[model samples]
Target chain A: MADPFLSIQHVRKSFGATTVVQDFNLDVEPGEFVSFLGPSGCGKTTVLRMVAGFEEPSAGKIVVAGKDITRLKPNQRNVGMVFQAYALFPNLTVAQNIAFGLKVAGMPKADTDRRVAEMLDIIKLPQMGDRYPYQLSGGQQQRVALARAIAPKPKLLLLDEPLSALDAKVRVSLREEIRSIQKKLGITTIFVTHDQEEALSISDRIAVMYGGKAEQVGTPFEIYNRPATKFVANFVGTLNVLEGTVTDAASGKVKVSTQEVSLKGKLNGSKSGDTLSLALRPEAISLGRQPGRDSSLSGEISEVHFLGSVIRVRVGIGGNTVSLDTFNSPATPPPAVGEKAEISFSSGDMLVLH
Target chain B: MKSGRFWAWVVFVLGAAYFFIPLIATVEFSMRMRRGAYSFDAYQIVLGDPRFQATFMYSVIAAIFTIILGVLIVVPAAYWIRLRLPQLRPVVEFITLLPLVIPAIVIVFGYIRMYGSNSPLPFLGSDTGTNSLLVIGYATLALPYMYRAVDTGLRTIDVRTLTEAAQILGAGWGTIITRIILPNVLIAVLSGAFLTFAIVIGEFTMASLLNRPAFGPYLQNIGANRAYEPAALAIIAFVITWGCMSLIQILSRFAPRSSNRPN
Candidate 1:
């Protein structure tokens, strides 16, 4: 969009005979926060490392701010990166670590000191400039890393699971802080993480990687609700996959268990009697029959989990079990297992997995 | 628990006795130069000798040069091996251990044969060249300790990530090594340096065969010619070695406590 700041075109990386990343491509807009979300060994970090110039792509080019940096060394790339393991110089103080790049760039001492102070302030650790990395807590250390990376005002910022080492509560808070700082600086940033929630909560867009390739790349909302592939849908969020058989090709009618549902134009090219896997989000299904819903499936209440704020129920229809969350209602008890149940949802909410 | 503690104490006392008894005997013998009197006369004589002063100074300078050369060679080699070619580790370790396995005299003879007066290098042709060769030999001898020290130091930190971090932050290889890698592992390097100093200071065979006027040869010569002064020199050498060890302990206290922590 409007002249991408970082463009990775058909990048591929292989270690000898094993290819870790293949034909990877992404164009990150200036100031846009995009996340490479995938499981471990999914090539998310490999692609990020290629962009950061740590790993050279075997094939294809990476351009940053209209300059081809595919062959450039990492130090020559002018890209800041915060590693998962803090990687701050153990011998240097927080201020010195932040000033490391500036000092290397031959910036004057006064200016370097000022920039380090500004960075410390930005990371909300204004008083930690004198402390060594070992003296800081996990969360504080990551914050300092973020500060150190951004201190040089590089063209692009890469965060490699910068919050993974922290505890759950700290992870949430630090992710939010990283997002806010990225926005404030308006530096085009690429964050790599395996956690879908983290990507969805913080990134403007997410590229879901699978099998060393990007399965889908889109805004968080689009990636979650309109996943392009089965991998994307399953990896992004929990999905209920119900096996169905198409009843009519022209009318887009399908049979799920004992119910006939109208899928309309959602099924693009399926013929009659063809088996299909229909997916639905937990939030799309209502516990019982509700008004304005076009589809209803009858099943037995198999399992019920009484969470504090919400109750999760799984209904067994035919061979498949569908899970849905409903708000806790103290006035009415949660449905019991081995009881008859009906789940309803809008027909449009169903996704025909291809 | 009582028996365990008692056994631990017994083991500690035995170890202390095993080490300190020889040193105590040497110190006692060193002071008995003046008959029927316990005086530091032997020490005064050994300290006042100009040959002792020259040889000691020469060896000290040689040790310093050896340390500089060793660090220059070992830190980068260890850093690179750990960062990129980790598979080469066992091979490099084997090469380093060769120094410990092969006798120092054998190495010195190899050096002399390779760089004699008529040889291509002719390192022994001049005093400066001979000193340089001696330092190089000492570096080779110190390789095992130096490499292991830096390698051990490299272990406590994330070498690859730290290198990449510095690289991404616009640091070149030189900057990364000098500013980042070196400082983080300074303690370990110092440990190796002190160990090398002890090894080089008392190293008699290499200095004697190389014909360098080093402290080791000086001690040997004095030990052969005189009795009291030799004991005195032995005690001084022991103090110097322990002083280096003590410095290592003190400097280690100031080393960065942790590098594996997040950030």
Candidate 2:
């Protein structure tokens, strides 16, 4: 296997009584974009800060390119960081901002100017060099910040919610821009974000953290479809959990009981009558017109929400709400509120998780 | 509404006049050298005097020394105190405000006893032992105002960003402080320096207690020995202070509209 470009070994951080990060370990390959996905205060940013040398780890070591960089100061680490606030120098023009890192590294004036011009070209803001950060929009400022951070050509780029300051459209577009730029430069990047869609869209792998620990780390598809922990499953996307009990033990199959019917699930160890939770994705459950459906439980339609491209149908199953989504089709009529409906799904969709 | 604004302006002008009347009277009285003969003799004599020049130079040297050392010492202390040692902030801020709380004579007397000759420490050794000690004293006195400017400057910019950005660019603390921080806070430093200069020029108690040659002694000498010259000297000092302040105002206006220097 190729050597890991960045090795974070069992890093931990604590503030007084609370642990911000615990036993966090991740290895990023060269030219890979990995995302730390979590809600606020979940230590995703803390890990990024540690890698950037802004925060020191209480325990463990960080190695970059085979070098132990745990104790090195931020400036000594040869890493670029873009903050959520778009912390651009208001006193410097866009070109000067891009050249700040080069200047700090004592690059010659001619070379600095060349690199700055190249940075502007790469960020696609070549003509806006003379404008100050205050003169630009939020998206423009973020681009300048990105350019400034990447201009030094550091091996690792750490982005902390870099696109969060922009509006929705700009946020999406700039994140795309950032992803393209990362690919173009072939730089190993660690992006910290709370947005699940962004993490799923732009990363080679995502480490979903909870309670200061990485709950799961896998490719975006695996993370979304096969989360390892309940935290990861619930945090990464909307999930509907149903109360159930195992009713079989052999042949790697078990029956999960709801109120009116038993749902089939793949379980190898669980015996009959053992309490468990039935984890199901909203898109996995299919609603139909059949009554007392075959191997499918029936529920009353509680609410129908028109969500533009897809419609959300909330069904009351055994006094618990279970949501299912369908693509917005004029031919596919939504179930009326309080109407009886049967929800069915293939055995592959039923996740026997506790 | 416009008439109310006009009335408010009238009241403000009246209040301003009330404050400047005494200063104007003093200056006019100084000009009436011979009780009817409006002559330039007082200013000429004061200008020609070797003692006045010497005292003025002393004050200038003391002010320059204070500005340099104060910036050197306080900027880092305030920066670190504000950024890193946040818990020690209140105590550090209170220490800087010591001069404003205690009387000047009380503090200067303590200084003389502690640092003057015959004292156990001999910090200053003699009356004329070290003008450097007097500058330290001046910096101590100017701390409250000067530190405020630098502190405010540090606040306006993203201190963490500057440090992190500088570090990522291969800049150590020395480079970050001098090239990044110092230039960004130049206006604040200038404002502090101007205030220090004014305080040092008019500071009578410290210079007198120390028996040091400074502008305050010259003013005192003129006030006691010559009548008209004191008025002229006061006017000169006022003009110098006013000129320095106005220059700062213009420079502050010329400052970038952005709270932080963007790069």
Candidate 3:
């Protein structure tokens, strides 16, 4: 990254004896939308707050546009933040709320009104300038908050779980709108959220955090398809793990339950008779035998879910149950629960975990 | 259910009579100064008196000053406590309640001893000093109502998030408090202000002891020497206090409805 717009270097945060964030670091390129994805109490919001100057870091520094703003007051740092609760001033009208930053900057009344109207249009709520916050819906309030944050055109934008308050449908739509707005303005942004799908769908790159540290930071494709750690793999998408013992380590032959399969150079450290966890995504496995797959496991169909576009089938082989998704075919009836089944997959798709 | 409704009305009627009968009696007696028929003669006499005008004006000024002082001191204290030092809330509540628990006579006497003419502060040595002391005493008397009103207002909004939001928007502390925090809590502050006004206007113990020519002292003096004028004054005072209460109710309708509720 050449001269990243925002750089957080070795930032650590603690409250008395409890350390929340530890040695966190990330560089966000200009106009790139990055997300800090993690579970609750995982210190994702704390890192974003540190960048917004709400919480000062215990160590290291934050440089935004070549200025070290670690110790500056939040007012001194020209950053815009949208809170999870949609912290719109209740007393002010929508236009006034959007113009709050401009007025604070000593902008003239005419310029403030023009800017407020422009922000209202950008958020697609052009006529809501006269309405108070209480009169707006949850989705509308969040849009107004987004508009308010960007009205002053700050150097960076920080969104702290801005879509978590909305319902499922609204959460999806608003997140897309937020992404589009971020792209249109080409502002460097940091969005903190615990929703994996939300992070994966909207972010250009994601920093998956755990235990107050960045476990993996990569593009969404890399984070989802090639997870760096076990936590990232399980947290990012649905995964199935099969416990298998290596029958022959040189050729990567492993036996799962009653069947034997060749993994072929996939296991580098495992020896014969050693137990290993072989992980696979649900889409990687196919029902019955397939032409291109080199590995096959025979089991009884334990469960079948008839979803609209896809059928989710779970096969039980001894004590291990592997879940896979198969397309819903109109020509063939769904598999029965007690029917004997054989699941096939490519040998290269199985991930050997230590 | 019918019997419950009947009994409820019965209890309400009893409560209404208990309160309104005495008030009706006072109003009736206040109109009897002319004799043989209801008349406004006593009201006319009392309203015309220069002493009444002087003392009432003094108390009104005192109430206004006391309200200003209370808001200046309490708003920042309550805001800071809610935003940064929430753990200290219980202790602050206890201190605010102390003014109510400790009798006014006890407080006035303590003030006299602490700031007498010979004392180092000497707040009672001059008229201006004594007036300041009286306003301070009234503010202490109104502390409980003012603090609770402002605290309740702060509760209805997300103080910490709003503060951070304003700060991040380039608003300094002054702008945040004056433009964001104060405007959001304006109704509650107004509620506290009116309650303070009512309390200060009718306060007697401190003003009487401090030798101030306030309405409360005047009402007491008239009650001791005159009959119908005192009755009229009592009705007027009741009207003023109730008017303040009504204003509080009316102003509350304009308070900004909060959108931030618990998820």
Candidate 4:
């Protein structure tokens, strides 16, 4: 590896007494779209700001393109950032906003204009150059902010909950737009958001942060499917941790007994006599299905919710309510309330956590 | 402005009248040049007098200094308090409210005692000293009001987001303060400055104690000596203050809508 495009080496931040980020370390590859996903105050945004040089770490060094930027000022770092509020300069026109960094760096007027036009074209708002940011809608203003940040062709792009402020419909569209633009530019970008869907959809790799630490760092699929910790399992998606014990350990499967049921789940690294607690995702679990010649768990349809495309059915499993989501068009109709439904999921879908 | 709330509207209009009647009376008194004639001759006298000119000039200069200092102190203080030192808020707020607790006379008296003849650090040892001390006093008085304005501005915009964005965009502390933070808080700063100008210009207590040839003392002296001209001067002061405040409102109205935030 020539050098990690951007590397955070065990950075830590504390405000007076409380330590927000502790021993945070990650090496981001070039042209990779990475997201720092976590709940509020999980230090995801704090880490992003540290990378952008807005914050000085209490420990560790931030290296960008082989340069030691641990102590470099934010202005000295060639990073473009989009804020949650968009941070569009109200007094400046869209074009001027896009050209702000170039102008500040003392670029010629013609070149600045050209780069701004290129940015506008890329963000799909070429004609909005003369308009002020206030004249535009929320989505439009964010687009302008995006264009302005990327216009300078920064080495790294930092988006701190850029789409978190938009409405649901707009959030999806803008997030997609941001991903496409990142791909087009191939800028090593760090997107900080608590929205799991947004992170899973856009990021090539995600460092799921918890308690100011990277609980797990992997592809969205890995983080969601093969969660490494209990926190990761609970935080990643709607998970049902059916507390059970390993009654028997076969070749690749372990039969676990819960309070009201006994089911066999694949234990990747578990021995017999060990306590086994596995997570099954709501979407992965199948509901209202025929009993196959496989390990079956007892379930009852306690409640049913009809989402637009899927039916979210909560099943009573071993005195625990496990939500099972199934597609609702032709495959299966949404389960009725108080219906006797048998739920079964593949062993592969079950995540065995130590 | 919902229609069909006529009774509420009536009560609101009455409330507005109740507050504005005294102001109207003052203006009415200023309008009459002679005992019976309604004319702007009072304005002519007020505008024409060199003493009034000097007083207004001093007021403007003092206000400009106070505003600059107040904004300088409050803008970053708001951001720092919000982001870095949140625990220091109550202490800072309490210090800011000191002006409201201590009257202008008492504060100026302290200044005279502390900085007057043969003191440890004589602030009134020279005219320059007196002028600077007066401006500092005014700035301290305006601190609470300016702090509120800046605080409100910070609340409206996402300060953390904006500051980080500016930083990432190659803005140093100086640039961020000048280009980003200051522009965003311009409306609040302007409104505070205008209000401060109005207060300091008409204030009679501090300038009298300090013995500065500023506007407030000039207004007091004029009121005591000249009767008709004093009313005219009062009207002039009212119009100027009103005009400055109105200008602030209009400028804020025309200010770009800062959506720099989520929907």
Candidate 5:
């Protein structure tokens, strides 16, 4: 690939004795929408701030377009940032707030007005130019904030949990709008969010962070379907860990509870009689046997949850409980608790964890 | 609920009457200075007096200087404490409250003793020096109000993020403070400034001790000699105070309201 537009190499940050981020690295292509996905205090925001020049990295270099920006001040970095709280200049009207960067750069009045109008239209709030931030709703204010950040046409755009404060419906709609706007502008953007679904929906690639390090970085499909670590598998979606013992090391066979399943080299290198952890996605398992399903286990129904379209059923096999989801149909009643049921899935669907 | 609201109205009416009755009597007494019928003779006399003009003007000038000095000292101090030295907030707040705890006379006395003619910094040696000392004293008096107001304003807006945003927009420290921060906090600063003006204009203890030609000393002098003019001067002072407070109320309507709250 050509040289990355933004390169973060071996960046680390430590506050006193507590290390917040350690050996973080990422190279983002121009116009790529990359998301740093993690829980709070996992250093996603810290990395974003370092990129924006708010926090200096304790180690390593940040290169943009092949130029080093490690020691530059935030003002000199020419980066744009949209914060979680919608930090709009409260005193200025929406138009003036969007034009703040242009005005500060000493752009001519006619040009500044034109750019402000353009930004207002881009945010889809053209009629709100004269309104103060307080007059607009929370969603509107955040949209204005996005317009303000991008009005300067900075080299890089950073969004730090911008949609975390909005409602559910607004959050979904606004994220779609943000994705469309980013594609239209073709600006290199780094989004930091703790919401897994948000990261999955908007990012071209996601870096799932844990304990101040990127555990896995890949396209959303790769990260979700083929997680590289147990942490990634557990954090990204609903997972069920089934404890089993390797019954035949030579043939990679395992005994899960009362059922014997051929792993077919899924296990890393566990010998016979050794305990192994196998993860199965809830959606990968079905309540009854289906075509092409080679593995099956009998268990008693322990719990049943009616979740509208999908009914989630938990079953107890020997001493372990496994959860699976089945589509709800009015023609058939859901299995009741204390009833015998058999769960089936293809052996290839199981993941052997290290 | 009906009884509770009725009692609330009763308490409000009683409080209003308790406060407004004295003001009504003072106005009535000030207007009855010309003859058996009410007239503006006392107001005319007080307004026409050269002493009134000089002392009132002096106090107004002093109030302006006091406000400027207060802003210079308090805005930066408050901003720095909030941005860099947040751990020192309690210490700074306690120091600002010291003026309130220590009486104005005691502070003025200390100023005289430490800054006497023989001392290295002789603030009481010349008339200009004495005026500077007076303004400093007033600034000290207004510190508590100014700091609290500005601190509250800073609390409402995330100062660190705003500063970072402005910096990323290519604004220097000066622009960040003057254009970004100052405009955001202008309403708070004006609120504090008007309060300071109201406090400094009629201040009696410090001006009397400093031996400055302020309106407070003038009002006292007129009260000692003339009867009707003193009431007229009181009315004028009340009007000025009311004007300052009214301006504050009007300005508050224009203050940048927090958009975080739902409409």
Candidate 6:
């Protein structure tokens, strides 16, 4: 592809002897919303800060729009950032805070006012121009912070866990609002968050990070379904692992519990009698026998959880327990605990861990 | 709850009486200047005196200078310590508190010994130098209060993030300090300034030793010679200090509220 809008090439950061980010690299397209999703201390925020020019990379380059801005000052880089805590100027009114960059750049008063008003309208807080940051709620303050960051028409937008501090209901709605605003502005944005659902819901692409490295970078469906690494599979969604032994290396047949299932190219070259770990999503398994399910296993019901919409059931089979989710229905009662149960899943759903 | 509130009121009333009784007596005695009946003659005399105006205006000018010098010294020092040398905070705090720990008389004596006419600095050799020395002395006395106020203000706002924000907005160091940081801490610095003003107005030891015509020295000179005027001066001094404190209270109401949300 023709040069990506923002390219982070081999960026490495170290503090004293401990390296926080090692050889981190990514290419973001223009107007693309990419999320750096990882747990805390995974170097996701460190990478974001490097992009924003707050922290200098120990090695490598950050090029934006064909310009190498690795050494440029944060202001000169023209990147907007929303901090985890709303870093709104406490002394300035909402309008003044939004107009700070414009004022500093010597934009005319009329133009500055017009731009500030435009940003306020974009964040859906047009009437709050006269309010101080302290007077607004947490969500409102963050929205104002968003407005302030974008008022300067920055080249890139960086959000560092912007919604982590909000309530659950607000977090859901605000994430939607942020995605829509990012689309409307079409600003190349990088979001750093640990919430898997948040990343999957809003991002056009996600870079799942672990141990200061990007383990996988793909669309949400690809990251969740075809997780390249064991870490990605375990981190993105709920998973169940079953220990098995390969019966035939040539035919890729593995014996899981008392059931002998055909792996058929899922196993990555395991020899006969070698132990292999297999993984499956909780939703991939059914409570009872189903048509077209080529693989089946019998077990006893261990525990049942009524989760309102989906009932989670744990089944004990051959010294191993596998969890599966079945839809909760009033017409059909869930299987009782200690009842013998037969679970079935498609052979294609099994992921043989490398 | 009722008894708790009742006892609270009782304690408050007792404290108020204990504090205000002496002030009331001073005022009543000052008003007893003209005759058996109360009159404004003492106020009139004190206000009309040319010596009083000269010395009071001198002290006011000196207080203003002291405030400027204090801000120039303390604000940058506090900001630097916070930004660059955070490890030096305890050391800097100890140094700032030295003025409070070391008595004013001893410090002024040290200044005299070190900066005498025969010494290399020779701050006492001329009137202007001596006046400057007095302003410096007042600033030293006010250092503890001024530094603490500004340091507290810095704590409310994240100094590192604020600096980065300003820098990204294309603000130079000068603009950041003058427009951004200073304005954010203006209320804190003003409170400190008012306190410095109060301290300098009634400061007697430094001015007396330095041979300046400050308000404190003038008050003492009048007290030694006259009886009623001394009480009158005391009341006036109290009013001036009260005015400074009232100004601080009003300014605090206008300070920028910290945006930290309640948990």
Better of 4 and 6 by TM-score: 6
The C-alpha stretches of model 6 lying farther than 4 A from their native spots are B1-14, B113-126, B261-263
Error of 3 at B1 (Å): 2.9
Give me the displacement of residue B215 in model 4, in angstroms: 4.0
Per-residue lDDT of B126-244 in model 6, one digit per residue for the tens? 99999999999999999999999999888878887777767666667777788778888888899899999999989999999999998999998988998788898888888888898
Span of 10 residues, lowest total lDDT, candidate 2 chain B: B254-263
What's the CA error at residue A209 for candidate 5, in Å? 1.0
- In TM-score terms, candidate 2 sits at 0.93
Model 3 lDDT per residue over A175-222, tens place: 999999999999999999999999999999999999999999999999
Question: What TM-score goes with each of the models?
Answer: 0.98, 0.93, 0.98, 0.82, 0.93, 0.94
Which regions of candidate 1 deviate over 4 angstroms?
Answer: B1-4, B259-263
Best candidate, DockQ: 3
Q: What's the number of clashes in each of the models?
A: 1, 10, 0, 2, 0, 1
lDDT by residue (B223-244, candidate 2, tens digit) is 9987789888988998999999
The DockQ scores of all candidates, in the order shown, are 0.70, 0.50, 0.71, 0.44, 0.61, 0.51
Worst 10 residues of 6 chain A by lDDT: A262-271
lDDT of 6 at A128: 95
- Model 5 agreement with the true structure over B162-250: per-residue lDDT tens digits: 88878888888888889878887888999899989999889988899889989999999999998788888888999998999899889
Chain B TM, every candidate? 0.95, 0.91, 0.96, 0.88, 0.95, 0.95
**Which stretches of model 2 miss by more than 4 angstroms?**
A249-265, A289-295, A331-333, B1-10, B34-41, B116-129, B256-263
- The regions of model 4 sitting more than 4 angstroms off are A15-19, A237-245, A250-253, A256-271, A279-350, B1-50, B54-83, B112-129, B260-263
Highest lDDT model number: 3
Query: What pairs collide in candidate 4?
Result: A85-B260, A85-B261
Task: State which docking tier applies to candidate 3.
Answer: medium
lDDT of 6 by residue, A1-354 (tens): 778999999999999999999999899999999999999999999999898888999999999999999999887888888888877777889999899888988999999999999999998999999998889988998898888888888899999999999999989989999999999999999999999999999999999999999999999999999898989998999999999999998888888887888988876667899998889898899988999888888999999999999898999989779999998889999889999999999989988777
Per-residue lDDT for A1-354 in model 5, tens only? 799999999999999999999999999999999999988899999999999998999999999989999999988888999999888887789998898898888899999999999998998999999999889988998999999999989999999999999999999999999999999999999999999999999999999999999999999999998999988988898899889999998888999887888888787678999998888999889988898999888899999999999999999988788999999999999889999999899989989877
Docking class of predicted structure 1:
medium
For residues A260-322, could you state the per-residue lDDT of candidate 4 as single tens digits? Answer: 233444565566677777788876777645454244576567888888877778878655688
* DockQ leaderboard ranking: 3, 1, 5, 6, 2, 4
